[model samples]
Target: MTTYDFSNQTAIVTGGAQGIGGAITALLASQGARVAIWDMDAALAQETAERVGGGALAVQVDISDWDSVQAAIAKTVEVCGGVEILVNSAGIAGLNAPLADYPVDEFRKIVDINLNGTFLVNKAVVPVMTAKGYGRIVNIASVAGKEGNPNASAYSASKAAVIGLTKSLGKELAGQDISVNCVTPAAARTRIFDQMQQEHIDYMLSKIPRGRFLELDESAAMIAWLVSSENSFTTGATFDLSGGRATY
Candidate 1:
């Protein structure tokens, strides 16, 4: 039996209260990392952090707001010592509708959280990682970004932006040992599903050739590797976890 050990590392997972983020948080904690969760939902975040154990904790944060994000990062650093791996998994699935029918405000909100949120968290952590000359970042993208979903225009575009940000940041930090990567997962049976109708769920499933929904464990497995010291020499690349749905 083998395991991925993240001992001696401090990790931070945004939206770590639930879904794939929750799984990642727990797994990392189990592997001996100090896991600190950042989420807008205070109670849920604390609950997940407690479940992770191993000196884990949760902080209420809105990643889109730099001020809020900055304070959250500060508190986590105080508790975890310093962040070694950062996973930008805080995101939202907006109302599914045609681009024409999408509300402008809603679109902006998605961008602010999905795209800008990633930026804020990275901005706050990169300098610390760079100084240490060792860091790993795994951002959560989407298969919809690869092959745009019909009614999820905002989501698709925001994820695409995340991929682009990963590429640019990876290059900027190429001189250092820090590597940046993103994962594009197909529609999974996450809490976001509750926001969608059955018709939409059926449509999403139809796109998955594997005929099954993505499990959070699967996503967490990939992310853990990306953040591990084992993931050397592979930066600025997007990992596709689309269950055979993504041709790219």
Candidate 2:
């Protein structure tokens, strides 16, 4: 466990109420950042924030909706000071089905939340961080994005777009002190599994050469440094957390 300094910083973690997002929020708060947990479930977000207990704030946010995102930013800034770090962990796995069999509405919904949502949140926060001339961002993507999954077309495509967005944004802000990057992680045993079919889950597990799923703390630790001041040279990059599954 490597300790990183986040003293006097403010972090916004979307989907921060549960699963990977919750882990990120807790770790950030523990390291001295005033964290804002943004989720669609207002009650769960508040509960998670309260549990973090360092003046952590919670705001109901629909990352896919422009208005909702704007409102969350306003609330976060007012309550948590300023947004210097943003971890876009808010996303969904759509459904497990072949492309032809995938539900049209579900596909759209997944893209809306997983891809458009990431874009919306980052778009809203970039300027705030740029004004300060310092910021750190970590967008949570997936290994499926790199190596598209058979029955998970929507999730793969959406995350692949996230990787592209991170690259473009990172380059756009290359001159600035702020850094933008994303992590492509293998499946982790999180509440997200509830949205997936057991067969699909098994398929994902089989792809991991490490013979196991990723741990929440491991994801949190990697992200902590990526969003820290210590990570000065890397931006517009993709960090692999696929447990020997990523070839590139």
Candidate 3:
């Protein structure tokens, strides 16, 4: 495992309670960064933070709501001192169904959490980063966003929006020291799989040329670098983690 120095840095990781986010939080903490876990699951967040144990704090947050996000950010800053790094990993994979047959409410919910949520969290954090003139942000997108997945229109669309948001924001902050970027990862077996149907899961697996699901630690390592000061010149770029699933 490559070690990156994060001494004196503070980071906020949404969805840090589990899955890829949990892995990220742990790595960041081990690298000497004070981490704040922003997640909806209070107990899980606290547990993960404790497990990380290097001044890791857990704050309940619903990234989809403006008020909720605002409160969470304030709380995180209050606890961790300031925000220098952010990893937007909190999101949901909506039900799989044909476009015409997709549930309207479900589609809206998916967008609300996956797309709008990223915007809200980014909006809340940019000013703080701007004031300091230094920061690193990594938004978690999906390969489905780049290459639309069958029967997963809502999820795909929401992730596509995330990619767009990351690009736009990265460019906006390019002149500054703050670097904002996103990653398009192929399917990884996480708790998120519980929300998806078996057919949908199998369909995603079939697309991965690697013939295996991505591990949480692999994604975490990539993200850890992206958020590190070492990744200075690459902003507004979408790093690929799709195992040959994305062409272009």
Clashes of each: 0, 0, 0
Q: Stretches of candidate 3 above 4 Å error? A: none
Count backbone clashes in candidate 2: 0
Report each candidate's C-alpha RMSD, comma-separated, in the order given: 1.0, 0.7, 0.7
lDDT of 1 at 174: 86
What TM-score, computed on C-alpha atoms, does each candidate reach? 0.98, 0.99, 0.99
The model with the greater TM-score, 1 or 3, is 3
Please provide, for model 2 over 10-90, each residue's C-alpha lDDT reduced to its tens digit, 9 standing for 90 to 100: 999999999889999999999899999999999999999999978899999999999999999998888877899999999
Candidate 1 off by > 4 Å: none
Clashing pairs in 1: none
Q: Which 10 residues in a row give candidate 3 its minimum summed lDDT?
A: 73-82
lDDT, candidate 1, 124-217, per-residue tens = 9998898889999999999988888888899989999999999999999988999999999988888998877787789889999999989999
Model 3 vs. true fold: TM: 0.99
